[model samples]
Target: MKKEIVDPNYKGEVIKHDVAKYVPETEYVVKVLERHVEKAKHNLKGAPIVVAGGYGMGSKENFDLLFELAKELHAEVGASRAAVDAGFVDHDRQIGQTGVTVRPKVYIAFGISGQIQHLAGMQDSGIIISVNSDPEAPINAIADYVINGTVEEVLPKMIKYYKANNK
Candidate 1:
């Protein structure tokens, strides 16, 4: 790369690269290979209930509780990007700006701090329930019901209640 002064204010101290241009070596034809798409295990878009988890859920093992709760609640599972990044769940289950959007009858957020990106995904739910230890969590502002407790403490009880009370 060759360097040159770009601004009049800057002297020899300022150096810029001489842009390089290149031509494509070859043009290749792209082919559609079977046109197969990998769909999420559950159709979150149509689910009446959605149970979403976030970074605050702690570990991947903790995420399992969400699944148990979903089963009892007859809901689909979803994750925040934070949860996906932490390897707590699969990317396909992510629900946020960078993931899929859902407007279910009931949206349950567990341990989610309510990032704007995450909120953009599920803010339109018919009912929003947030379970977080912090009362001032942003998710709480939008939640129809705010349960002030950690996921580990709250999830099992919810699961048990649903299992016992479910007809």
Candidate 2:
């Protein structure tokens, strides 16, 4: 132990003076105690339906239609990595191998072309419905139904139909 001139109230600290040069390593183990996700409209992992969009949505203003459709379907909102990176949505809402995985009963993808990373997260969904203008979009391969239209053209109709039918 050595005293330092820096502090008036100096607490003795252990000092290693003559020590062999050695590399230090760290090993960590994480145990799951309890898994908890807040129950909310946008809770992706637990929602029975997920309404997801992608960079193909074009802009943040255009991307917002997914939220309206999600609300009508009582679904959560998710986004592709490209959508999150492009500032169309938040990272928490991202779904893929790099983000949260969801196996919802219904996954309605809007504008997403289904990058392989994204497919990993949502492929287990009970039913996948893709809405894209691209008839050859990779997402179409996995989807149970494919709507050959843009989200702008399809989402309003979906929301309107759901709203009217709910009444």
Candidate 3:
């Protein structure tokens, strides 16, 4: 038996061979099936800035401070699973391995311990700012800037500074 290769774009030459002696034609039928698709609701996929709160926020009332800062910055609000489980925010706002991923220009984490699961989602952000009382928190390791203070103490000062400077 012998084999020959042909160029698909060679219009100047023609070659013929008998392939019926070694091969046979086969036909295939494809079946189309229908399935149901559910659309996901709106999320913070493209927000330029995001503020995420964690359990260290202390309570729902303390979490409200983050919202005030987010409002001032014109940023979207997010939360860790711990905050969502604690009913501080809705599940849609959760950010982690089990939540929506985000790549914002700036990610400000308040009271978050920076678990691996949470880091997986936002580690690619252009800048990461962490605020926590513990200096040894895991989130501090990846933070571009770390503020060692409680959210209530630090966030108010940050908001005041932003307001003072932006004006």
Candidate 4:
């Protein structure tokens, strides 16, 4: 019996692109992740912070606000696939069924409408806090504390409060 040889150019063969355009160009993601890890190692950190699905965080610029808040709080930043897909965050910091599963001490949901898939990853967190303009947002249902307001407004106040009280 003769052995058959497979063609290298077979149509069924899968090929990956040389570069991925889907990845973000921002260097801040790396800086933020590294800084948070360093802070955690030094015990100069706050509770783990997972920012849920991106609903009101409409653009990458909006997501930067979350980074600012995280920096102020000295907390780790996490996000949902929607936020990554929308370029609000890098894929590396995603937290959901398709991403990293985090059980942060305080999971902050900012502008996240809370899809079930996203909630499955962080629902077991020690404390769940959500800030949304709509009180009826699904994320509010699972949150231990709900702040019905805009992230832009609430995050500053929150950062201030946590720093003052925790310190």
Candidate 5:
């Protein structure tokens, strides 16, 4: 029968065996494991609101204004590479091709020119509001709302409005 099964030319007789009779019966018990959730160390990643500053913000001292606005809006502060490179902000706060990526519900860019590298990190934001002095700035192109004014001028009014209405 083995020779008949192996030989292609052989007219073979078919046979069936009860393999189940020799097989062992086994049972499996599945246990659900509890999920371990870890707390995030960085507060910026999941921030609902983010306020990013760029080189156009002028000086490091100007970041105080940005921070004031961020406080009013309850937003995290982010910075472009230029701002970081200029020593205006810390490296961890930098957001761009070389920095941390963010997808905030509302991203308010102040003085950021919208360089491609910078845009890559933040373009996924749900709503983008850009405040820039230059009307032709690249950031304005992707902005849901573009405010054509210096951050110094625009931020204060915005902060005032939020405080007045949020109360």
Candidate 6:
């Protein structure tokens, strides 16, 4: 009988999917969660939102809208691996297969091309909104709502509208 391989690159580093491993310190995990909560509070007050993207926005300044929106919502900002690798965002803010996994109230994907690796980290967000110039961008398929437009045009309008209404 031939045994089917789960992954050709398993490489002995991954824990088995069906196996339960001891984490050794539940307190440590709790402390880390608490620290994340505190830092998010310190940075965002009551906001618990995260924005994710790639460098598809075309320019660094254009990409600033993600952070701007995050600030407006008093939320955290995150990016896909490509965004960080391309220097559009910092490594600490990278989310995806090799980065932090986030469970935020809202996950906004702005100009993100939305590779599957990027989606894996944020697919469970309570709400997901994607904005992209390309209507056919892969991320749109997974988004709860898709805004088809340039981030530059869409973000400013959104900011203005929210600011006017909320104030």
Question: Which has the greatest TM-score?
Answer: 1
On a 0 to 1 TM-score scale, where does candidate 3 land against the true structure?
A: 0.73
- Per-prediction TM-score to the true structure, in the order listed: 0.79, 0.76, 0.73, 0.65, 0.74, 0.69
Off by over 4 Å in 6: 1-47
Off by over 4 Å in 2: 1-41
Evaluated at residue 54, the lDDT of candidate 1 is: 94
Q: Which run of 10 residues does model 6 get worst, by summed lDDT?
A: 37-46
| Model 3 per-residue lDDT tens digits across residues 1-167 | 38779778877856687887656554224445887777755447788999999999878887787778888888888999999999998899999899989999999999999999999889998899999999999999999999999887898898899888778
| Clash pairs (backbone) in predicted model 4 | none
Cα lDDT tens digits for candidate 1, 23-68:
3334335556687778657788889999999999999998998989
What's the lDDT for all of these models? 0.91, 0.89, 0.88, 0.74, 0.90, 0.76
Decide which is better by TM-score, 4 or 5.
5
| Clash tally for model 5 | 0
Per-residue alpha-carbon lDDT of model 2 for 46-150, expressed as tens digits?
A: 999999999888889877777777778888999999999999988999999999999999999999999899999999999999999999999999999999998
Give the winner by lDDT: 1
- Considering summed lDDT, which 10 consecutive residues are worst modelled in model 1? 19-28
Better candidate by lDDT, 4 or 6: 6
| Candidate 1 wrongly placed segments (more than 4 Å) | 1-34
Per-residue alpha-carbon lDDT of model 4 for 67-115, expressed as tens digits? 6667766677777788788787777677778876778788888888889
Q: 10-96, model 6: which lDDT tens digit per residue?
A: 767655663335454554664433433333323321237876667776666766876776667777877777778787767777777
Q: Whole-model lDDT, candidate 3?
A: 0.88
Stretch of 10 with least lDDT, candidate 3: 23-32
Candidate 1 global CA lDDT score: 0.91
